[model samples]
Target chain A: MAGLLRRDMLGVALTVAAIMLPVAGAQAADPIKVGVTITQSPPGSVVQGTQVKDGLEVAAKIINDAGGVDGRKIELVIEDTQGLPEKARAAVEKLATRDKVVAITGEHQSSAALAGIEVAHRYKIPYINTNGWSDVIREKGYPEVFNPGNYNSRVGAAAAATMKELGVKRVVSIAENTDYGIGLAKAIGEALKKIAPDVQYKYETLDRASKDFLPAILPMRANAPDAIINLMLPPAAYIMMNQLYEQGVAPSAKTWLYDGSGLADYPDFWQNVKEAGKGMLVFGLYHPKMAQPALGKQVGEAYTAKTKNEPNRLLFQAADSLFLIADAIKRAKSTDSGALIKALGETKYTGTRGEITFSKDKGYAFNQWLDVPYVTFQLTEVNQKVGDSALVSQAGQPLDPAKLWKPAK
Target chain B: MSGIDVDLAVNGLITGVFYALMAIGLSLIFGILKIVNFAHGEFYMVGAYAYTLIALALGVPVWIALPLAFVVGALLGWLTERTLMRPLYAGYTSWGLMRDEYAVIVTFGLSLFLINFVDKVIGPYAYRGPPLVETSRVVLGPVLISGHRLLAAGIAIAVIAVTAALIKWSFWGQQIRAVSQNRLGASLAGIDTAKASVIVFMLSGGLAAFAGALLSPVINASPDVGIFPAIKSYIIVVLGGMGSVPGAIIASLFLGVIESFGAVYISFQYRDAFGLILLMLFLLFRPQGLFGEKGREV
Candidate 1:
């Protein structure tokens, strides 16, 4: 009878061991795959893409090192859109269907983002637009989409305010022939009409793909505008700046070259533009001196360690995108598309830049970070670091003329 | 004319010169091979990268780098003709019915391959080639121009003249002309038609590459930088009369001036459209172009 009892106990222990083995495997859980679409090749701004990728990578490492969200490591599935709309659409579609990413994020170019979001909306996957500034993006009002980055209207308002502060009567905006460039150019004009009615604002749309802007720019030299705002991205922007400077058009005593594209923050800004960048006012989203969250400081430090490059606005935006996605996953307690979207909608997490919260208002503010911090700084000398540059305006502050630098005639 | 008008003309003329350099090569290939080289733009791209990288990375002088870029482009063209173009024409008319379609597919595939290959290898960053002259600006009368632009414009004029003279007087040039007029007849008459095709391709590649190297500083060497120039060259080629070197030069200048003036008075957004519009009008009215022969010669 005792031998029979020993055999039964042994069988019971074996059954328990079998049951616990599967449970332990389930507890480990698979990595939560997130899709990222960025411009990794030409015709798109690869510089921006590289920076965004590094930022996402840095943030992912930090999250995984901290044991990941809800014990599932974050995995970024990056796709190169080549800065083309069709490619972006295809990339998002492939990521959503084939890769089975839990969430999609990291679209930096506005044109590509505009295309990628449509696919994300159709699939009902949560999309966090990292840096597309086009106002039309939010106006689409996709419930699945969230923007924690800069917007065109905010830059428009800031540019208009600066134009008023500088007391410029005539402003010409040379914008790229794209949704971001044209939309932002129009927004600036509207803002100018409301704020400073006396200002004469007219915008010229140049094909971003076309390398030569001399035909468009030469006409400007005959009647130089008070302030020539750059609404284009590099390397086109760099070419335009060089040509303008070579022609003695802007950044002179008579005219101010105000950059609304936040160009100075780019890693290649100084190398490409050289002396032309001097005395040019930049609408900056990030500065070394700006106040950031503890997480922001940590991410910035970690990014510098990884890329050996100074932290820029896109870096913070990209980091915040991943953090928000991770935060949503934690709140939802599941990676279901519907649950993640709901969690992202109610996001109030403190990210790298500030305490992030998305507004539900229509137009530019729809699911957008309404209080995105920005400042206006001018490069006073060649190869000037963002820290060394003079900041003429701070977050929610008027322009300080005393700190503004102008090129001597 | 106002100051802007003169500025537009000068800039237009300079731009036209670059367009002509690119178009001449495409014209030559069409004259000899009777096939549209869709990979022509990539040849320009290769040249731009070659010039920029050699000067920037290898520490070579800009002048030497410019010629080296041309040589690289010529070599690339020769190799492409040998490997890709050889298969298309070998069994072409004698056995195959899809020679035209095959040629299109092969050249198009070659174009995509080169673009992606370079993008992967070099990384997608644009590099500005060092200018021949360090001086930034050179004022001429009322209009102001960059020193590099002025220097490049002069060099282009000289190159075009040399290329035109060579094609008109040289033995190889006469042989290319004969092959273009009657390929079978020329082959029967003891002219090496294949050799003429190879020579045309090399010359074409060299000229396009030279143009790319010259404008690298202004345009900044990127993978897709060739696309814009290639489009302009296509329009100029058709407008000037395909396979007509002089016609390409004249049409390129005309198109450039019209585009410059049109951008200012009409719309800068539609500047590129002007060429397409002119191309359409020419296609409708003058199908043979300014200097093209009335009958198609195979």
Candidate 2:
């Protein structure tokens, strides 16, 4: 009787193991879906979107080539936001609920990012902001969101410091009517007030959709400021810059044109601006001469190999964004949102740019990689590449006026 | 007037010249078809891409590429009229009730199609067309302008004059005008109304495309680059008079000058709104527009 009872229990245990083994194998073989929201088409910046997409793909290829995280492949489910808030909200909702992605990332535009984070927060999914520079994104204090990209305060302080070093008394910002543009404009104002109180600063918000800016620029010709800061993005920024140059308002011997929006790194920058871009000061997050980690080199090489174009800051930020997600998934050992969020919070991973660790501080610093490096440079010639441009200032260094070039009126 | 005011006026007039280029084509289409062609802006967008790619990618001379853009746009307009617009006129007489709805839906669809098609085929990167001249800045006393812009403005005035003359004197233009006045009467009078419609579409497309090619150096040609111009064209069409060519030209210049002055004096932020406000006033008070005759249907 004892032998028969033991044999039956062994038979039941064997049957259970047979069912569980295949299930485990299938789970290990499954691809981990990461949601990506970007403006694949305009009226948003498709250039930025394309760059971010390329970077994410490069990072994904690297991860998968080396046998993806914990024996599972990484699959990106992308949705087009078209840089509209309503579209972004819908995209995030679709990504979180419908697609059931583990995490969401690759949002470059600030207004879209702001809208996307709300849906991510409600769904309690981890969101990695790629290149939205608005501080309000961090100020919202959503635990689900993590900013591994540049923020407005950092650029504001940099621009202000550059202005102070250049000793410009009056500065004007031609900002677009978007959160990123307006926020950075205000941020620069705040920073200038703190560092150079005597300097007069004002920003004019322009419609991003409008093609002409001659009217706004005409007034500047009457009594041009000492310096003009560009807080707008292309192609509006390009038009504004051309108009500014045509009106002899900025970038002249009397006034300087400082680009706070990192427009110099764009592939179409020279093609669009041409002579207008010459003698312009740029607040750049990535210069070919800047010191980068091994991971950065690897990503840059891979990107150049894939695209034949030079690697820009958005590429590194986007790659880092995806790498951070993969790192969190590896540390957590699970695809669950709660586990991923917790793992991401305690992240100390070295990404493409550098060792990225999220800050615990509130406001703009919350969950942000605070020490993202930057440099200041000047474009001295028309149709000049960013590599050939003179680096006026290195990261964590003061601007050298000797290295700067001004247009002789 | 102050130097700035003179600057504003000169710049405004130049801008108005380009506005006239876009508005004239739209005005012509409305005059003949009596239904708005929503894809009018896409014609401009296509011309922009055509000119930029021909000059930049194919290494064609800017002068040749400029006219080629017009030809491409005209071809597109012909094709659009042949395939999409014919259904509105063919196999249906007195279909005025469905005309507006059908035209709207079809043209709107075409606009979306063209935008997405260009975005996919050429990619989303903006291409700035090469300037006609290498001179960056041209100063005329108080006025400062790009050499390319000055030349383009001059070309625009010439084009507008030629177009107006053609409409007033050309044989096809008279037929188009006849069709505009009374489609049924023109058809009964042995005028090839369909041919007239086709010609108007082609001319409209060509003119809009010409404007686009001319401005591509300044605007940077992209998929959605035509959207703003299209909006401006719409306002000008109404403010000038829906189907009056002379009215469109006058209104275009008027709107441009007002916006330039309003931007500096009133608020730069409200520069675009100034046109819309004028459009509203025109719609409410002068529904017939500056030159449009009220209750003129035969």
Candidate 3:
């Protein structure tokens, strides 16, 4: 009877061991899935979306080609947001619940990002914000949410400093009616009050979808400000610039055209706005002259090779987002949401931009890389690339007024 | 006022002219069919894409692409009438019993389908159609307008004039007018009512598409680019009276100038709101509009 019992126990142990072997092998071979949400269709900035997608793909290829994390491949499951808030919400929910993505990333629009993070927070998934600029995103205080992108306050402070250097007494900002635009516009107002107290400033909110902005721009013709700041994105920004130039408002001898939205990096910028972009001051996040980390150079080279287009700021931000997620997964050694979140919090990864580390402070500083670098530049000629443009100032540096160029009246 | 004010006024008027072109087609459709063509904007969108893709992608010249855009719009209009609109007047010869609700739903759905389809197929990036002239800017008195805009405006005016004349004196024009007035009576008088509706839809679609092609360089062609123009067209149709082309033209210019001046004087933030407010006032007080006939209930 003892011998028969021993045989049965041995058989049960063999069966258990056989089941565990395949499960372990499958774990080693399975790919880590990362979800990306972007506006691939109408009503969104497809230009920005395409750039983000390209950057993410390039980074994914680099990881996979390098044997991936722990010998497992990185697979991107992309969902098109169409730049709608409801679509973003649904997409994040679907990605987290059904696709079982380890991390959620690649949201460019602020409104869409705002909606997407809510779902990510609910699911306790790590969200790496790619390009949403609104400070309100970080202020939401979601532990799962992390930002490695430019912020509105950063651009606002830069614009204020540029305006002060240009000796502009009066300024006007034409902002699109969105969270990013309006938030930046307000931030500029606040920053101006602090840095240039005597400077007069105001902002006008324009519908992002509306083509006509003449009425808003025409009023400025009579009492043109010293500088007209653009807080809108393309193609609306392109239209506004054209109309402003046509009316001889900005980029003229009297008034300077300042683009706070960083419009100079877009590939279509020159094609749409020919002469309107000349002599325009831009709040740029990426410039060739600006100091970048070694990782940034590698990512830039990879992006240029893959897309055959100049690497812009969005590319670095998007690449860093994916790279950071992959790094956290590696550190965690598991795709569990709890473990990944803890690993992401302790990240000191040197991504494409800089040594990115999330802040522990509350509000807008929460989970944000507080010292993201930026620069201000000027487009001295038509169809000028950001690489060749005149770099007016570096991060936290003073703009040299002598180096600036203005149109002759 | 500064020289810039005059420039704004002239540019505003030019924009108004394009708006009139789009609005007139919508007005005509409403006049004849008594139903708003919600897909009117899609027709314009198609024309813009057709002109841009043909000129840029296929290496066709700008002039040839412009006319081709019109043809594309007309064909789309014809197809829309044959497939979707036929159900409205298919079995019923009588005018009063036409399925107006069905027409609205079909056109609205068609509009959605076209927008999404373009987004999926052509991609969503806005392509600025090549200009007729390569000249970037030309100074005309106080105004400094793009050379392409000046030339396009001239063509638009000529096309609008030709459309008005065709609708007034041509044989088909008279039949269309008769059908719009009293479809049953026109049918009894040996006029082919169905044929007239087809012609009107085609003309309307063609004109809107022509406007889209002409302005594509300035507006840039995208999947939902036609939405703004369609809204403005709806407002112009109501302001000019439901079916009057001349009324639409006058109203378009007036709205444009008012919006331009109001935006500057009141608040630039509410520039689009001015049109909506005007529309509301017109609906509340004068539903018949500036040139519309008073209701005569039978």
**Top candidate when judged by lDDT against the true structure:** 2
Off by over 4 Å in 2: A1-20, B95-98, B296-298
Off by over 4 Å in 3: A1-6, B1-12, B53-64, B95-98, B131-151, B293-298
Judged by DockQ cut-offs, the docking class of candidate 3 is medium
lDDT string, candidate 2, A4-53, tens digits: 98999999899998999999899889999999999999899998999999
What candidate 1 gets wrong by more than 4 Å, as runs, is: A1-28, B91-98
Q: Write the per-residue lDDT of candidate 3 for residues B1-298, one digit (tens) a residue.
A: 6786786688778888888988888999988888899999988999999998999899999999999999999998889888888778976556568768888899999999999899779876677788899776788776677788899988988998998999899999999999888888888899988888888888889988988899888888888998988999999999889998898998998888877777777876777788889899999999888898777212
Q: What's the best-to-worst order under DockQ?
A: 2, 1, 3
lDDT of 3 by residue, A1-409 (tens): 9999999999999999999999999989898999999988778888899989998998898899999998999999999998899999999999999999999999999999999999999999999999999999999999999998988888888899999999989999999999999999999999999999999999999999988787777668778999999999988998888878866888899999999887899988887788889999988889988888988898899988887899999999999999999999899998899999899999899987779999999977888898898888899999899999998888888998778999988
Sort all candidates by TM-score, best to worst.
Answer: 2, 1, 3
lDDT, residue A257, candidate 2 = 94
Model 1, span B195-215: residue lDDT tens: 887888888888888888998
Task: For candidate 3, report its TM-score.
Answer: 0.93
Instruction: Score chain A of each prediction against the true chain A by TM-score and list the results.
Output: 0.95, 0.97, 0.98
Judge the docking of candidate 2 as incorrect, acceptable, medium or high: high
Q: Single out the weakest 10-residue window by summed lDDT for candidate 1 chain B.
A: B90-99
lDDT of 2 by residue, B190-209 (tens): 99888988999999999989
- Which whole-number lDDT from 0 to 100 does residue A325 have in model 3? 91
User: Which stretch of 10 consecutive residues in model 1 chain A shows the poorest summed lDDT?
Assistant: A395-404
lDDT of 1 at B202: 87
- Evaluation by TM-score, superior candidate among 1 and 3: 1
